[model samples]
Target: MVGDALASSPGGYLLVLAVLVPVIGMLAMPVMGLLRVRHAASLAFATIAVGVAVVGAVGWRVVGSGEALVYGIGGWSPPLGLALRADGLSAVMMAMAALVIALVALYARPQFAAAETAPGGRRAFGFWALLMGLWSALNLAFVGEDLFNLFVALELLTFAAVPLVCLDGTAATLEAALRYLVFALVGSVLYLLGVAVLYARYGTLDIGLLHELAYPDFATHAAIALMIGGLMAKAALFPLHLWLPPAHAGAPAPASAVLSALVVKAPFFIIVRLWFDVLPGASHEAAARALAMLGAAAILVCSVVALRQARLKLMIAYSTVAQVGYLFLMFQLTIEPGVPAWATIGWTGGMLQLVSHALAKAAMFLAAGLIAEALGHDRIDELAGAGRAVPVSLFAFGLAGLSLMGLPPSGGFIAKLLLLSAATLSGAWWIAVVISVGGLLAAAYVTRVLKRAMAPPPEGIVTSPVARSRELAALALALCAVALGLVPLQPFDLLAIGRAGVALP
Candidate 1:
């Protein structure tokens, strides 16, 4: 079954390139910087262009062919060798990572641009290199077929992301970085423990083999529980989310954008893989409800926290936690038996929420950065001059806010609507109520910032002008979030590709 499902397709080699391109660029960055610091940024951007194109090609092939693109290393099949595979979900995630990373590179270019003889080129060069490394890890996480291979991807992701938080070298940022590292390391340990248990039980670490061989035994149950608990911490779900706000708020804007938009999603994606692919039959309705309960708590608790934040970036960071809650809700809503989970409205809604939030949150972080630049501060109270100084950014932030608020003609609205429908059909009244309440809370927090920004500037406060190019980059991302609303209000066929007969894992 695993072999039949994973046979290499026509464009399978693209998956190998998808992982390799950014890695090659990451290795080349330091060499370029050593020769000429300005050349490093150029190399990173060149890599971004090619990487985005490669990911795009993969997505196109997946959608056009409606098959999983698979490439086994050294022409050896799984369980004995490695493989990279891109199904619909993998393609979409890779595309999302590529798009967000590229836009972030654009936004960071002006700020990090160094002269041929600039003294502090290390910071600039580090940003480009780390960004490449992050991109590489993300692609690997999305495509890797072996469990231990995914573990390596997760480790690379953590190391690449930790340094991004403290790029400025401030005491506070360094502390935040260290805190993030500790939490991520704990997650890695639990995840590895689970993988070890699975390997000992089944003697192979390939996902497809595990899917075929796994049974609802004590070891399997315990291993999955440990792995899920660890992933929840990495994904910043509810009670374990303490490290997220500080790290995201402390990082530079471009770094903040990718961290919030793409980095955290990687773990959540793995959680999905574990639940649906690795142990589908072992999943219980009670356990599913428990996960949704935690998600509800996150939505309620984090939304209130966001509303209370005084700093713009901190508020956005808290909002990320709340938005992530929506993804967890999908676990329960997608429990319809005899139907593939990917074919359900809940799955579509959850995926839409992920994509929309990624675009919107990236835009909001970039906009907040520009707003901070214009006023030399991010205090929500002092944002009165932002509308006058950087109206484009303010507008971009508001547009992105529309998605969070679940307003009409935006992706968030469609996503929540679908979730609400699934809850209604399944008689999950509590989930339905939480979805609605989450929207209201989102609106309250968004309006709190917008109202402040629209007010007149305080007496004698002058604002600096931001570059239009940077402002437009943010606006473009926000627009993409809005454009997702055009997708039909149903389970997407694109997402269903490569998921036939497979229950949601």
Candidate 2:
């Protein structure tokens, strides 16, 4: 009985802390800054440490007990009251968020440190506060068991993220931030309309209740379609990804890392919930294939576009869109009507791609920031002296690129391999072909940057030295991405821990 699995297990209070600590840290930032600006940074770091530990503890409990951890809020259970739950998938996401945010903080510390009452201190404090808010929203999205609550998290996420894009206050970045805001608000409206439709029909917004109550009807199908469509816009999947490149490329590197690696994933996570958890009986193979086709387009088209980008950050931004395409492929690969999707190799591959991409992309962006810092600009053709100026950053970029290219002993390799195996097993040969072509395209673009970066400097070029600690921070993330490839090439049992007997939609 999965019901027993949601009975407010021991150590469930950790979920409350996971969400609360970040909110508290965010609220406290300004107050601490009144006395000393640097205090805000100290508090933010402390919050990160505590949040990471809380997530680690929750993950430990879920894995050790081999069960989902659930906490009914205010002593009330579902359909009437809210609940927070951490299944293995949720645990993995929370852990990934914690790790990425922590490492990003490490990389951002020197730039965003409010050590003195300089003009930059205010922006620094704002960055830390917004980051905490974003972390809180991400945690809530992962743990919340109600549809409306997840929407609230999404709203918080959008609000926190929009300001980050224009933090530099440049005219172009401001325009980009405005564009991102418009798209995000549109997605929110669509998602909210779906939620309203669901609540009107089902009389509840709780996901578990909807799982049992929802049937394949006009209302159900309409709501699910609306919700998924909105999420696709937010996730920056192809055709809807217009705002992503400019916004991500314009933002500060740490903010860029967060937006690419985590912010987009939140909405996609909700899409997963809507598809598999709330609408388990609503599986439509045609719809699944359609989503996969979009993914294939994203992979092929974006990779080609990325290859032509002149700016390092823009190329990485486009690569993010392409990598996201891999996630949607899981729908077609794992959509067995009666089988739990998480038990499949396709599902595991999709998730591994998410984690590895988060790590790799974060590393890539941070390294790009260092390269720009040392070389004074991010122009690809002008990057001749970058290797000599920021060798660690260049090496980190190459290491992260290895994963993106699906090279051996890297997470992306294992993930794509699993996806290919699933496609072949299911006789979805077209998907297998797309996967291969995507890898080759990714390789071409990644090597394009590496080849330019490793070349000798042109005459009269100047460079500055970047902090070794910052370069090491980026390297750490890249190493983690590669480390994921060490896991055995098979469906992960851990991902299936709470999904046993759960039907796929």
Candidate 3:
């Protein structure tokens, strides 16, 4: 299987650095003997900025040349060594993760400030380090060309993420973290089982190679089922979503943002690669429809659950489950015989939803955090004065809600509209109906919070003012979500990049 390395792209090395920089920064924190809060924060942000730059360069190269940036490790071809490949999807996702993480880091700085008297003064350092580690893992997941390498990335992501959920070390947060760890491990085991099955059957784990080699065999079918099922568990889709709400609502807002916005999406990303790129034909149409139906269930059930929440954070957390369902709905709509999945409207629609939701949900969570801080609690009924106390954050929250509601001029609007159109065009009436109802349900929950927030303060409720920087960070993310709608209604060619022989989006 080892041979002449696939011809390297002009900027392919950047792909390796994209994954390595954060790992290096995470490691260097100890090596450089600079774990102080100030030093940690500075190092983390600088590394993230560099990561963003690298992602931008990769995106430019991919979009300019219309191909993937691939680097075979040590100039060795796959099956002997590993390869890192960055396509348009990786570029966009890497950039999005970097930007969201940077904003989250800024938002978290004051919250995680190390106490002078705390043991070893590690709170702040831990936060920054874990953030960097998570970033590294996310980049690795996005660019990983092998199932085993992606497994390693997924494990790293879980390790870094679980700690963030319980940064305060409270019993409740600890319990939530433990629950997350346990379920995520279940996912890992299943994924690994499928990986082992695939490797044993085909003698390779490279995704591109598997795409060509895999056939409609029992082992192929079983591995795809197990792998996709495992990924869904990690992704916290409906029915398997029990661990997400408490973990997200209980974690610090910044951690919640990272978890909800980026981490969950990583497993889902791999699931997509497995289905559409690697084992598309091995999985039957019933499987895709089943996934879409589960998504529809998540949307309907979780939206109602979110609406019932009295706490702002809980509401946002449940809403995340609801929104995540939309990602799965695209599966049935995008994959039809003789059509490259990437060429379908569902492809762009689903990906845009992922990006837009990341930005919007991060903004909403930050805004919720700001509100919680201002009021000393997150009781929705008592948030009457929040609009007056933190108008910027409140505005940010509302703007993000607009996206979640699929309102016009927001990325969510374009994304859902495209998906809904795809469903209708493809004669999937039930899917179109579900998408419509999900949007309405999303609007209901968002407005429920907005209504309470907009109410006048009840007899002088107390509220602390939010810092301008924190408020701006939230607003910036919300705006990015809104701005995603500016891409023309027609197919976005940039999103279609590197999907060889696929019709343009």
- Best-performing candidate as measured by lDDT: 1
- Candidate 1, residue 179: the lDDT equals 99
Error at 52, model 1, angstroms: 1.0
Give me the overall lDDT of model 2. Answer: 0.90
* Runs with alpha carbons beyond 4 Å of true place in candidate 1: 1-7, 36-38, 502-505
lDDT (Cα atoms) of all candidates against the true structure = 0.91, 0.90, 0.88
Give the higher-lDDT candidate: 2 or 3.
2
Candidate 2: pairs in clash: none
Q: Model 1 lDDT vs. the true structure?
A: 0.91
How would you encode candidate 3's per-residue C-alpha lDDT over 141-172 as one tens digit per residue? 99999999999999999999999999889999
- Model 1 weakest 10-residue run by lDDT: 1-10
The all-Cα superposition gives candidate 1 an RMSD in Å to the true structure of 2.5
Clashes of each: 2, 0, 0
TM value for model 2: 0.97
